[model samples]
Target chain A: MKIAIDLNGGDRAPEEILKGCLEFLKNHPREKLILCTTKNEPDNLFDLNHPQITVEYFTHAVGMKETPAKSKKEKPDNTIEGTLRLVKNRKADCAFSCGNSGAIILNSVDVLGLKDPNTHPSLISFIPLYNRPPLAVFDVGALGNYVFNAELYFAVLHETVDIYTKLYGVKEPEIKLLNIGTESWKGTAEHKNIYRMMSDSLYNFTGNIEGDELLFTDASVIVTDGLTGNIVLKLLESFNVLLQNFRNFKDCKFDNNYLNFLIEDFNYETIGGAPLTGVNGKVVIGHGKSSSKAVRSALELCVKYAEI
Target chain B: MKIAIDLNGGDRAPEEILKGCLEFLKNHPREKLILCTTKNEPDNLFDLNHPQITVEYFTHAVGMKETPAKSKKEKPDNTIEGTLRLVKNRKADCAFSCGNSGAIILNSVDVLGLKDPNTHPSLISFIPLYNRPPLAVFDVGALGNYVFNAELYFAVLHETVDIYTKLYGVKEPEIKLLNIGTESWKGTAEHKNIYRMMSDSLYNFTGNIEGDELLFTDASVIVTDGLTGNIVLKLLESFNVLLQNFRNFKDCKFDNNYLNFLIEDFNYETIGGAPLTGVNGKVVIGHGKSSSKAVRSALELCVKYAEI
Candidate 1:
């Protein structure tokens, strides 16, 4: 299997991404990689001399601060778009990037197109819970610029259920709407309308799940709008940072192994990357601050999708 | 100061509420209390013979499962309404309850009335951080039923700024909009529009704050719509529960005092209660599952508001 990796994506991009590529290739020597970078990137920065690695240069790269629409119009031949194009042309089985989430979603849609044009690209993340099977959170960051509509939500819901059942082997996973309260009338009028739609559908639509129950929920799939999902996913990730500050505040050392057990799933380094479902081709996204290990895990994750 | 306490609110009511009142009176001998309960409540359930304590009976009480609109129409004379009436009539200096938040907002507006008719009641909670002074999170639950409008949001912004300055003595606090991303074009068009309004206004609008920076932000005030605020507040509160589960999973005990310092502000037991601001009279709301100690702390919080 072959995977295309975007080198001009995150903060420590080209350097850390190259290291991750080398690490991934070392473990899986048979796999091939297409490394995407900017045309201006100096060749001496890293030795891309391996037979397993191929370099694909792009004309422009999206900045972290650029809006998706502005970047797409101005920087048409960006690195993320070029990387996903490899998957589109079947040059690579899948693709991985650690770029701005909005830009990634737009580029993925433009390059690979959507399986269902009515639905936006939904980012599904597997959340590890204590003493329970991992829970799936949908649309972590794919719909930042989109508006809310019943048809769009229904499409995303079906996409989430289909992908989750296929990956986790749950025939009919309980689907829960992420809301402020468990009661049917907890959120705004729009939320109630969505709740009714989910209930009327053939899926196993459980009522509502509040943020407090996020870590302890028995439901297999939790669906939310892209904005809410993005905030929630980041909030869970921030726990790793909070725990570190807490340990420092207490001026005490915890056994590193035990601490890892408590927060391993919450960290990108351990949990790896999330998949952007609903797209025609397989795509995995890493955290923008992803370390070398995290980037490698993202590639490994892309490989898993390829196998699936 | 005479404070009205809702005895028909919360999971452990009557018995727990009585216990909290007793605890409050023991420490504050000069304070007066008016206990509100349902007419069906047994007289022998608790002793209310003290000179400082007076019992007031109501015809109905709002249940946890009932929607605010249904309850308001069906049960017009609920215990929460009766408790706030005491404040409205100048019979009590302030009021506190662990009742349904929606009902509380409706009853507070109907009874005590809003300070600004255009703005919805905003629930402001003070969050304790690790090293910095406490941060304020606005509209934690009050806007659950309201729709988005610029005039309403502007009113809420001013109300939050006024209250935060009065409470914290910050002349011009840095105001932040809670959003999915820090970029100007991060959220939906509606969010970008609000961001523009805040930036153009005289308040120190400090761009957008993401969920991950929630705990680490240096901004004094974080403002958001009710639905987002409710989810964020509950997510922060859930950390206390998460920490307990982690300790159990690890089978190791840390010093309880240090643990208290880390999560105290996040819990109603330590933070006491959050005030529903933008109302003419003081209204404090407690957690539904608040322990007797939390109830007492909430009443103490009401006293602080009364003095102000």
Candidate 2:
């Protein structure tokens, strides 16, 4: 499979990005890579002589602070646009970025387009739950409002779960709507409408699940509007940071090993990036401060997802 | 002050409930209590002959599973209704219950009525933050949808904060809307409208705050619709539960002391019951599974809040 990667993305940018690419190439010697970079003289660490790697230099790179839509419209030759064009032209199976997620989503949709115009692209990530298969949380930040139809949202979630089940050899996933209460009467009119739609649809719907259940429940797919999902995701992230700080405090009497183990579940670097699911083309976006390990894992995910 | 107590409330009703009241009475010998109970023969633990305590008998008790509105209407002599009536009649300065929160809220609203007919009562709880004053979270589960007016909600929150500032001797509290993003453009139209209203209003309105900031930000009050607030509150509760489980595991290497300290912050029992704010009467509702200690703390809170 041919995978395109943006070298100008992320906080560590070209250095970490090149190291990740090299790591992926080392593991999958048979696979090909289309590396997009804006630098005239690439970093010395990057092995330009790799036979399976191709370089496509761009004239500009999207800044982290620039508005995504505006930048995409004005800077036509930026890395995000350039890398997506490769996927658009069928030159690569998929594209991956450790850049500003907003830019990635805006450019991908504007360039590669959506699978269906009526459907919005959602950021899908796995939240590892102890003793159960990882729960899939979708639309973490892709769409801010409940703009899509409930039925369409369910269809996208079901399809994503189906893909996971097939790839990971897990059982058929049980879908649950994340709400304040497990009761049918809970949440807004939109939530109730979604619950009714899911209950009536062909998907294996297992009623409503509350936020507290996210850590312990057996539901494989937890669906929510992007706003709630983003808030929950970020809340969890910030909580993990607090735990880490507590573990590192000099006066803390806790055993560092156990604290590390407790925090392992919250580490995004371990699982790498989340995919922009439901888009017409494959795209993965990672954390801005991703380590080399996270970048490598993101590339591995790209390959694994591309095969499906 | 004559404080009303529900004798038949909570998971361990009458027993733990009475124990908590006794604990409170033992500490505050000057305070008066009017206790409501459906049981003809109260538990032996309750000091029925205490000079400061008076018992009120009722024929029926509200069960935990019954619908709040229906139960309040049908069971007029229930513990919640009886206790609230004492407050409505000015027979008690405040009321405390470790009962079904739904029943407490519904009964309080229907019986005592809100300070204003157009106003909705919100469940307000203090979330203790590290090295800072506790943050007040409103509408935790009181109003499920965004049915309350933005301006009225702000006015109520501002008044509550002002009262707290005067009583607690803290600085004027800053209020922020709990939202998906810090950006003014984020969240639903209702949220944006609230933002605008708050900005124009004569209150110390901070911009929108994300869930991740709940634990760390300096904002004294975080406001949101009940659905989102409930989810966020429960999510934090569950996260703390997970930490406790990890601490309890025999094989875990963490120091029990530090783990215990971390867990203490998440303990709802320590702070006792949350107030059903905006109601004309003072009502505090504790967890159903509250222990004697939680009950004691809740009574103490009732005394403190009543003084305001």
Candidate 3:
């Protein structure tokens, strides 16, 4: 199996990306990697002589501030577009990017194509819970403000969860609609309609769930629009960072280990990156500031998803 | 100043509510309390004979599960309605309820009326930040699923912030639109339009702010539709509860005091209740499961708002 990596994607690109590629190579010796970089010559940190890895050079790199649609159209040789091409042409099994989430998503949809052209892909992230299986939150920010049909989004989410359940060996994954309240009458008309649709379907529809339910509930999959999902994802991310800063308090009486453990649940690095599911090909997008370990985890996630 | 307290509201009604009334009476000797209850006789927990307090009995109580609008229409004697009636009839300066937030909002709007009937009320909650001033998040549950005008919402938020700044002696409270992203191009067309409108207005508009920015940003008042605000508020509340459960880990090495301090920041009980702003009369709504301390804080909040 082969996986394509975008070296020009993340904030700490080239060096961290190269190191992560090495880590992936060390862990999965037989799995082939196609690394795409904007640099003509690879970074000195990476031993390109590794037999399992091949490097592809791209002339252009998309900046974080660049509009995804415009960048995709204007820069054909951009690392994100180039990486997606590899997956599209069957040169690689899957693609990974830690760059601009928006750019990666747009370029992936444009190059790799969507499973259903009528529907947009959703960004799905796995959040680890204390005692239960990790919950998957979708549309973390792929569609943005674009009005989407609730039924289509749910259909894509259902199909994505089916693949995830089979791949992870999760038995009877419960699907839930994310809303402000769990009551039947609560939420927008669209949300209520979607809830009813899911309930009538064959999926293990567990009814409506709230944002707080994400951490403690037994539901395996939660669905929402990109706007709400993005806010929820980022809020949790920021809260985690705030908690980590608490460790800096030298005079505090809290146990360091317990504090670390508490913050650990929210650490996104442990989960690596989010997958752009409902697309035709396997695509994973990491945080812009992902560490080398996180990049490696993103690559590993692609491999796991590729197996499905 | 006279503040009305609902006795038959909240999960722990009558007892907790009565205790809170007594606490308020003890703390604010100059403030008179008008206690509304469904019971003919007080719970005996309260010193009803106190010169600062008076009890008014009602025949009906609204359950948390009952529909808010339907309940307001059917049960005119409910504690929420009865409490609001005191303010409407000029018997009480303000009112507090730890019952159903929806019920409080609807009954308050129905009984006391809005400052402007065209402008819907927003549920404004004060979230205590670590180093910075507390952040006020609005539309926590009010105006649910309604297609509200952005201009009206912003107007109400701006007016509310102006009052808050003057009342709390806040110097130049910055107002921001709560969104999925900080970029100008982010969020729905309505959000972007609101951003532009606020920018042109006299209010200190800081453009669109992501959910993560809530914790560390200098923006004093964040505005969003009820659905998003409710989800965000509940998400934080649930996270706090989850963190509290972590205290059960006796073997962990974290400092208990520091851990407690971190958890305390997200504690809803500390803030008492959310004020239903944009209404003609002052109405503060507390969490349904509020303890006596929280209930007391809610009553104190009503007094403070009444002073404004």
Candidate 4:
């Protein structure tokens, strides 16, 4: 199975992305690594004598600050759209990028197309709690206000969780709906109704899980709207600073690096990127500002899902 | 200034509530504590005979499970209603109850009236986190969804924080508008607009504080709907159990129960009894299943704010 990597994506672009492609080839030995990029200049990595790291070139690139639709329309020669095109044509099994998140999402939806009519896919993040593996949280910001298909919003999560369990080998990962309170009686009218609905025996449901129980507890999957989920995940990216403030308050001390490591573990990309599940095509999204390490993780995730 | 103690409210009504009341009265010395329940047929000294704990019979009692409106209509002689009548007649400066939360709200509105015309006072809970002093979260579920008054919403929390500072002797505690994330760009349309109104630089705005950071951190006042605030507080109640499970998963041993004192330091009542702040008159509403402890807390809360 072949997986395509975006060599000219994200802030660091070709260098970090290319470094990951080479590393993956060396580690796996048999897999073909397709590096899709725009030939802004031919002198850089064209001379690297690597047989496994195959290059497919376009002539333009998109800057991160540029609007997604603008970049898509203006930069037809951009590598992001070019790489995705390869996958749409069945030239690869999956596509990977540590690029502009907005651009990636826009392209993934507009180019790859939705998996089905009923399914509204979201950008899911796996956060690892203290004892449990990673728990999936979704629609981090796909839609705001948590309305329109609230039931189907949950139904898609049901399908996503079913896939996550089988893929992750979780014996019985408890699924908890993230809300304002643990009581079914708490939250807005919609949240209250959802809590009561989950109370039924249909799914192995735990009552509403609070946000504070997120990474420090045993809840496997905490579900919520994209607005809350996205912000929580983004704030998590800067948690190193937050940990020190916490340590001072507790009047205790721990390794600073350990704090970041533990916090990073909660953001499931520490394990690997998640397949944009329920999509028509195999699409994987990694951190837009991903390092070589993050790229490697996403590739491994792509490989694992491809085999599955 | 006198505060009527129900001596019967909360989870541990009368006993714990009574002890807390006596402790406060003893410390304050000058404050009058009116015990406003029917004298028992056979009672112990713990149930009677304090200099300030004067017995004033209400001729009736209320239970946790009784329907609020029905009980109020059927039992006009109830201690709760009697206490309200006392407040209205200026016979008592304020009334307190630990039992029948909804009953307290309904009766308080009917008897004393709202603090102002537009008032919809909310409950505020002071939760302690290591990173910061106990944060105050409001509206534990007093107001229903649809049409939240922005200025009144701020006033509810502004009054709550004012009380926190007065009681705790802290200056300028950081107030945060609880949101889905702490990012520069995040939150719902309503939350976003409210956040903008709050961010006018007139207040010590800390921007958005995500739900997850509400625990294990220091935040002085966290504002949200009663539904959301209670949800997080409830999880905090169950967090120790989850922590024990987390320890087991890591195969680590620690003194969990030994730290129960620190764990339970966040007394829900210190900032007890959600006052429908905007009402025309003073009204303190306690939890329906409030035991003695809750009753005492509500009494102390009202007694402190009796004049205001």
Best by lDDT: 1
B134-221: candidate 1 lDDT, tens digit per residue = 6888767654454556456667778777767876677789988878878777676767888888988855888999888887788998
Q: In terms of lDDT, which candidate is stronger, 1 or 3?
A: 1
lDDT score at residue A304, model 2, on the 0-100 scale: 84
What TM-scores do the predictions have? Answer: 0.93, 0.89, 0.93, 0.71
RMSD vs true structure, all candidates: 2.5, 3.4, 2.6, 6.2
Alpha-carbon RMSD, candidate 1: 2.5
Which lDDT tens digits does candidate 1 get at residues A1-308? 99998888888887888888899899998999988888788868546578898888889988866788889999999889988899999998988888877788888888888888787677888776655556888767655564556556677777677767776677799989888788776676767888888988755888989888887778899877667777777777777776655454344445555455665545657656788877899888888888888888788778877877
Q: Which stretches of candidate 1 lie over 4 Å from their true place?
A: A131-133, A143-146, A245-259, B143-146, B246-260, B263-265
Model 1 reaches what TM-score against the true structure?
0.93
Q: Quickly count the clashes in candidate 4.
A: 43
Candidate order, lDDT descending: 1, 3, 2, 4
Candidate 4 global TM-score: 0.71
lDDT of 4: 0.63
- Candidate 3 yields a Cα-based lDDT of 0.77
Highest DockQ model number:
1
In candidate 2 the C-alpha lDDT for residue A301 amounts to 83
Please provide, for model 4 over A195-277, each residue's C-alpha lDDT reduced to its tens digit, 9 standing for 90 to 100. Answer: 66667644667776665567555656676656556655655554433333333434333334444345345343464465665
DockQ of 4: 0.18
Candidate 1 accuracy as lDDT: 0.78
- Model 1 residue A172 CA deviation (Å) reads 2.1
| Docking band of candidate 4 | incorrect
TM-score of chain A, every prediction, order shown: 0.90, 0.87, 0.90, 0.83
What lDDT tens digits, residue by residue, belong to model 2 across residues A63-136?
Answer: 76566677777878888777889988999988988886778988888888888776667788877555455678
